[model samples]
Target chain A: MTIVSTADLLAILPELLVMAGGCLVLVLDPLTAKDRKDWLAYFSLAVLGAAFVVGYWFMGALTGSPRPAFSGLYVLDAYGAFWKLLLILVSGLVILLAKAHLKLEEIDLPEFYAFILLSLSGMMVMVSGTDLLVIYLGLELMSLSLYVMAGFKRYAPRSLEAAAKYFILGSFSSGILLYGISLLFGRTGSTTLAGIRDGIAGLPPGDPILLMAMGLLVVGFGFKVAAVPFHMWTPDVYEGSPTSVTAYMAVASKAASFAAFLRVFLEALGGIKESWRMLLVAVCIATMVLGNVVAIVQTNIKRMLAYSSIAHAGYALIGLVVADAAGTASVMLYLAIYAFMNLGAFAVVTMLRRGGLEGDEIDDFTGLARRNKWAALVMLLFMFSLAGIPPTAGFIAKFYIFMAAVGANMTGLAVIAVVFAAISAYFYLRVVMVMYMKEPGETAGTPGYDVRVVASPAAIAVLLVAALGVLILGVFPDPLIQAAQSAILPLK
Target chain B: MVPIFFAYFALVSIVAGLLTVSLRNPVHCGIALLALLGHVAGLFVLLHAEFVAVVQIIIYAGAILILYLFVLMLLNLKTEERYFHRRHAWYITGVGALTVELLMVLLASRFSGAKGPATVAAVEEIGNSTAIGILMFSDYLLPFEIVGVFLLGAIVGAIVLAKTPSPADLSGDER
Candidate 1:
C-alpha cells in the first residue's frame, strides 16, 4: 500500500478545517462558563465560514481535472465543491438560527453548536467522497449528529420521540445501504465508483444481483431524502425536532445525500441506467402524488412543510430520472434554490417560538400580516418560491428540471410533475392566505391577540439572506445555472 | 476434519439463531443470542478469518450479550404470547415475503454465477490484521478520520440525550 501523502491531506483541506475546528470547540465548550455558551455559536460559525472559504479556494483550483485523493476514496472536484459550499452556507445560517432559538426555547447548551459543526463536517465529507464505504461513513457521521440535534431539547418528550423515531429508521436505512454496498462489492469486487463502473461494464446489462443492490441503494437514499414509501418518519421527525434542526434536516441533509446519491448512481452505476431509471421513475411518481396530496390536509405548519419538502424531493428526482449531464445540473440548481427557500420557510417557523407557545399550528399564522408584516412578507416570498410561482427561484428550478426531463424524452413525467406542482400550491398558498386574508380568532384560553412571537435580529438576518438568495436566483438564474452546469463537467 | 467442524458449527448456529428470535422469554432470547454469536465466530474461524472470529466472540458474545442481558433483566418482561403483533399482520407478511424473495435471489445467483477471483496471496503472506491495518491507515485514511468524527457525534449525542435537564433549561429565555 502507498503511504498517506501531503497531497491527499491537502485535497481534504475543507474537511480537515471542519474537524479541527469542531474538535477544538468541543474541547473548549466544557471549560467555558455556562453563560458564555453563545460564544460557541460564533465559534462554530467561524469554523463553517473558514471551511466555505477553503471550499471556494479549491473550486478556483479545480480548473482542469478533478483531484483524486486517498487512493480514489475521495475526489476533490467541482461537483463536490458546489455541494460543499451549499452545505456550509446552509449550516452557518442554521447555527445563526439556532442561537436565537436556543435562547428563546431556553435550552442553552454548547454541545448543540458542536454537533452542528460536526454534522456539517460529515456533510462535507459525504459530498467529497466517491467510494461507497467513505460515502456511507460520511452519511453516518452526518446522521448521528442530526439524530442528537433533533432531540437537543431533551426535556421535551416530543423531541425525544422524534430523535428515537429518526434514529431507529435512520439506522435501519443505513443497514440496508450497507447490505447493498456489500452486495455490489460482492458482484463487482470493488467499492470505488470507477471500479464499480468498470465492473458493471464487464457484466451483462441489468444483472439481477447488481439490480437488487441498486434497488436497495435507492431505497436507502430515498429514506434519507424523504422519498415516499420510505418517508413515514419525516413528518413526525420534522414536527417534533427543534425547528432549526428540522431546517437542517430538510435542506442541508437532503442536499448532502443527493450529492452522494448522484455521484454513486450517475458515475458508478451509469452503465446500468436502464436498470435503475424505471425504479426511480416509479418512486418519483409515488413521492409527488403522495407528498402533495397528503400535505394539503395537514394543519400543522411543520408537518405541511415536511410533506412539501418530500414533494420537492420528487420534483428533484425528475432531474435524476433524465440521467444526463443537463439533468444532473438541473438537480444541483434545484437543490441550491431549494436550500434557500426551505431554510427560509423553516427560519420563519423558528421565529414563531415564544414563551409557552410552539407556534407550529397553521392557525398560529392567522393575520400574521397585521401583526408582523415583514415576517408575513418574507413568508409570502418563500411560499411563492416553494409553490413554483412566477418570478421566484422555485419556478425557475422547476422549469429547468422539467426542460431537462423533456429534453430526455421524459415529457410524460414532466407533465405529471407540473400537475403535482400545481397541487402543492394549494397548501403553500393557504399559509399565505391565512397570513393575509383570514382574521385572527379568539376561540381558546390562549388569546390570539397576545401571541407575541419574538424573532432575534440574527434570525431576521437569516431570513433576509434566504429571501434575497431566492429572489436573486429567481430573477437572474443564468449564473447559477451556468455554475451548476460547470459543476457537472467533471462528472461527464 | 474441516468439513465435519463446519457442519457442527453451522448446525449450532442455525438452532441458536432460531431460538434467539423465536423464544418468548427475553432472558432466554439473550442467552440464545450469545450461543448464536459464538457459533458464528466458530464458522468465521473455520473460514480462516481468525481475527474476525476473535473480535466477534469478544464484541458480540462478550460485551453486546452482556448489554442485552442487562436490558432484559432490568425490564423483567413477561413472555409475549402473541408471537406476532396484532396490528402488523400486513407489515409482517410484507417483510417476510421480501426476505424470502431476497434469499431466493441471492441463493440462485450464488449457485449460477462464477465465483469471484481469489484473494491476493499477498494478504495471506502477511497477516490479515496487518493487511487491513495498512490499507485502513494508508488508502482509507480519510474514512478512518471521518469515523473518528462519527464517534465524536455519537458520544455527544449520548451525553445530550441522557443528561439530566437543569431548572434553568426548562424556564423561558434568559437572553
Candidate 2:
C-alpha cells in the first residue's frame, strides 16, 4: 500500500470540509430547537463561504501539482479547481437566494442545507473525476440530492410529479451511464481515464466496445446537459423545482457537469474524436434549435426559462464541439455570464411573487415595469444577456463561442447557433415588452399596494442577482474569460 | 468456486430483481430489492472485489434501499390494500428485460479484454482498496469534492421547501 500524503488532503480539503459540514448539519439538525434550526442555514453558508476560499487556495495548488496523493485516485489540476470555485460561489449565492424564496413559500427543513452541500460536493468531485467510478459516484451524489430537492414541496402535487418523472428518467439514464462505465472498465481493465486511454490506444480503431461505451455515455451526459432527444425530463423537472433551486440546476449543475463532460471526452477519449465530433454537433444543433423554438410558446415563465436553458446548453456545447483552447474559454465565459443572467432572471420572478404560492405565469409579469422599474430594468438586462443582445455579457459570450467554432472549421454549426440566438431574442424581448407596455391591476388586499411596499427577501436576492448580471463580468469580462482559458484543458 | 453457487446467485438476482418491479405492494418490492442487493453483493465477492461487495451490502442494501422502504412506508403506499395500474405495465417490463439481457450479453463478451491488466496490474494492491483509493485521490480528487456541495444544495432546498411557516409569517404579521 502507498502512503497517503498531507498534500493530497489539502487538494481535497474544500470537499472534505463541505462533506463533513453536510454530515455535521444532518447530525445537529435533530438536536437543535425548532426556530434555531435556521441557524443551520448560517452554519451551512459559513462552511461553503469558507470552502470557497479553500477552492481559491486549490487554484494555486493545481498548477504543477501532479503529485499522486491517494496514489492516483484523485488529481489536482486547473481543470478541477476551476469548477470547484464556480460551484462554491453558486452554492453560496443560491443559499442566500433561497433564504427568501423558501421563507416566502413558508417551507423549511434543516435537512435541505445539508443535502445541497453534499450534492455540490458531488459536483466538485465530478469536475475532477479522472476515474470513471469516481464520476459515477459524483453523478449519483448529485442526482440523489437533486431528486429530493425537486420534490421538497411534497404537498404540491406538481412538485411531486416532477420529482417522480425526474427520478424515473434520471435513474434510467444512470443505468445507461453505469453500463457504459462497466463496459469501459472491462475494455480498459482499469477505470481511470489514463488507463482507459492506454487500453484504447492498444485496440484497433472503431472498436465495437468503445463505440458502445460512447453511445451509452453520450446518452447519459446528454440527459444531464439537456441535449436533444434526451431532454424530455428537463422541462418538467426544471419547471417543477422551486425557482431558486431551478436557478442552481440551470447554472451551477449544468456548468459543473459540462466541465466534467469536456474533460472526460477531451482527455480520455480524444483518440475517438472523429467519431463523436459529428455526433455531438448533431446533438448541439438539435438542442439549440428545438430548445429556442419551443420556448417561444411556453406560458409559464419557469418552463419558458427551462426550454431557454436547454437552448443555451446547445450554444455552450458548440464551444465543446469545436474542441480548441478557445472553445474551452468560450464555454467558461458563457457559463459565468449565464450564471448571472439566468439566476438574475429567476430572482426577479421570485421577487414578483407574493403570498405563499409562487407567481409563475407570464401574465404575472404584466406591468412589472410599473410595479418595480428597477426589477423591470434588471429583468431587461437579464433577458438581453440571455438573448445574446449587444452590450451585454450574453453577446460577448456568443461571439467567443462562435469564434471558437469557426476556428475549428465548424462555421455551419456556429451560423445555426447564431440564427437560433436571434430567434431566442424575440422571446426574451417579448417579456420586456409585456413588462413595460402592460397595465398593473389589483382587486384589493390587506397589505394593499397603496401602502404596503416594503422590500421582501426575494427582492433583496434579486438586487444581488441583478447587480451580478449588469455589473459583475459584463463590464469586466476579460478576467473571467481569461480564467476559463487557464482553468480548462489547453487545446494546443 | 462452486458453479452451483454462481447459478444460484444468478437465479436469486433475476428473481429478486423481478419481484422488486412486479410486486404491487411497495413493501414487498422493497424487501425483494434487499434480496437483489444481497445477490449483487455475492456477485461482487465472486468477482474478488471485497470492498465493493461490502459497500453493495452496507450502502446499497443497508442505506439507500432502506431509504426507499422508509419512504414507501411513510407515504403509506399500502393504503389501497390492492395496488392497481394500467395493463400497459407489461410493455415497460418487456423493454427493461430486453435491455438488461442485452447488457448481460455485452458484458459477457467484455470479460476477456480487461482480464489481463485487472488481475496482474492490481495484485500488488491489497483488497483492491489501495488501487481504488489511488485512482480516487490522484485522478478523481476534483469530482470527489464537488459532490459535497451538490448534497448541501439538496439539503438546504429540501429544508426550505418543507419547513412550516409560523402563523406570524403566514398571517403577514412578522417580517
Best by DockQ: 1
Judged by whole-model lDDT over C-alpha atoms, candidate 1 comes out at 0.87
In candidate 2 chain B, what residue range of length 10 has the lowest lDDT sum? Answer: B166-175
lDDT tens readout by residue for model 1, B90-171: 8768977997897787666643333333364665788878877887888878788888778877877898788888876766
- For residues A1-492, what per-residue lDDT tens digits would candidate 1 score against the true structure? 678899988998888888888888889988889778888888888988888998999887885569998988999898899999999999899989989987777676888888888888888888888899999999999999999998888878888899999999999999999999988888888888998888888887757799899999999999999998999999999998989999999999999998888888999998998879999999999999999999999999999999999999999999888988889999999999999999999999888843376688887888888888998999999999999998999999999999999999989999999999998999999999998997665556432444556879889899999999999999999988987888884543
Candidate 2 local lDDT, residue A100: 72
State, as a TM-score between 0 and 1, how close model 2 is to the true structure.
0.84
Root-mean-square deviation of candidate 2: 4.8
Docking class of 2: acceptable
DockQ for all candidate structures vs. native: 0.53, 0.24
Q: Estimated TM-score per prediction?
A: 0.95, 0.84
